[model samples]
Target: MKKLNIVFMGTPEFAVTILDTLYKSTEVNVVACITAPDKPAGRGQKINQSAVKQYTLEHDIPCLQPTNLKDENFIGNLKAINADLFVVVAFRMLPEVVWSMPPKGTINLHGSLLPQYRGAAPINWAVINGEKETGVTTFFIEKEIDTGMVIEREAIAIGENETAGELHDRLMHLGAKLTLQSVLKISSGEFEAIDQSQLTEEELKPAPKIFKPDCAINFDWDVQQIHNFVRGMSPYPTAWFTMHNTKADNNKTFKVFKTTLHSSKANEVPALIELDGKLILALRTGSLEIHEIQMEGKKRLTAQQFMQGYRPEEWEITL
Candidate 1:
């Protein structure tokens, strides 16, 4: 059998793992790597290459950075290489001219199981919605975004209190492994991509891109909601709220990382209490004990440790 010629497109660390794995396989030759252009980052304002681009450079692989995916020049270069297959992970949507070029077409590895959580930020949304399990899916890219036919899927249980960051790591590796499986099967002509609608599942919950307002914690929700929200947003674009001392008239944003749920009946004020050196947020059905937090421009501290130096008697949280 002839060895497969593949071209990969991706931009993040997650995508680099898959490309690295595929590049090592003897059955396929990764002809080229396509990633986003480097831009200035950090306080010093130096050029920062994407994780995929950095890996490509270090490995001496052919790399392309196209400011416009559909530009005639980029398209011309893609035709010149003439790869047989394409793989995408954590990359922008492709135009028909690019994705339809290869005989095997494009295969995408999504962070979440297909036909559900079909959008950006799947890992974050899964934890925020309190899902019991989540997984990765490899699918054939079609015209519609994420509405493609499924190639293969692997499910993993979500830990009772798993943070989004933890789940992200798990799915990242799992996606790499599953993508390898798909590539091998495709090379041998044993793979049959299945339609997502044929699987038959419940309603789909979108994983839309998260914004700053979405990360704001709402004390009016149930304690469990607050708990999930904190865990889901942990370590990135963290769940935050503005806290102020009514007497001092000073306000600062506090990012919540960890919390524990506790039942409560007293109709006390919401998210307003520092009883016994604990930062307590009174939710609708119970109290949320904030275990870990980071004040604006300060280091992360435990609730007990934070209360020891600060007084909540004059503090009031806004949203």
Candidate 2:
């Protein structure tokens, strides 16, 4: 069997996992890697190499960090590889000249099932929308983002209280396995690609990039909605809210990391409450018991720790 020569492109930890799988496969030869350029990061401004780049360096794989994909030199270097196919995971959008250069063309591993939740931040959006199930998709790369023909898909159920970070870990491994399978099928030329338009008729949901403002918790929403929002953003761009301090006459921001819903019909004015030694955020339809939180300018703490010096009676959540 001829091992398929592939050029892997991605930058993040998720991409690194997929790249590792391909690198270890007997049927695949990862000839080269294309990842983001190393840049100074953090308060100290230390140079940081991308996860994929680090892997490639450790394994001695030829790596390219092109500041401009369209540059003649970069294009010439990529063409020199003469790889059979290109494999993309969590990478930036590729130009036509780059993706179309390989003979077998490029295939991308997407976080969500094709034709649904098609965009960046698919994992976060699926959990925020309270999806019961979600999965990964491998498809051929096309002109439009995530609009390519599907080569493979593997579904997984979403836990009711699972955070987006947790779900991301599960999908990362699942995606790696499916990607290997897709590569083998392509290597043997035994699989048929299906058009995205023929997959489903339901309205497609877009997973646009999330910003800080998008992570703000809306107390007016139902308990389930608020709960979903908190978990969906937990551990990154965490869900947050503002509260007015009566004693200090100031507003403080609270970043919520963990929350559990208590559902019931209620017209109570949303506010912070302490009941049975637990900190709860009252809402329109119900309340959420905050398990983990970080106050503005304060370190993250448990509900008990947050309640030590803070009195719920002196604070009211800003609607």
Which candidate gets the maximum TM-score versus the true structure? 2
lDDT, candidate 2, at 61: 98
Q: Write the per-residue lDDT of candidate 2 for residues 1-319, one digit (tens) a residue.
A: 8899999999999999999999999889999999999999999999999999999989999999999999999999999999999999999899999988999989999999888999989999999999999999999999999999999988999998899999999999999999999999999999999999999899999999999999998776888999999999988989999999999999999999998875433548987888889888877788788899999999999999989978989998888
- Which consecutive 10 residues in model 2 have the weakest lDDT in total? 259-268
lDDT of 1 by residue, 1-319 (tens): 8889999999999899999889998888999999999999999999999999999889999999999999999999999998988999999999999999999889999988888899988899999999999999999899999989899999999987778998898899999899989988888989888999986579889999999889998777767887888889987879998988788788999898887775554335666577666788775577877788888999999898888877777777775
For all predicted structures, in order, the TM-scores are 0.94, 0.97
Q: Give the TM-score comparing model 2 with the true structure, all chains together.
A: 0.97
Q: In model 2, which regions exceed 4 Å deviation? A: 263-267
Name the regions of candidate 1 deviating beyond 4 angstroms.
263-267, 272-278
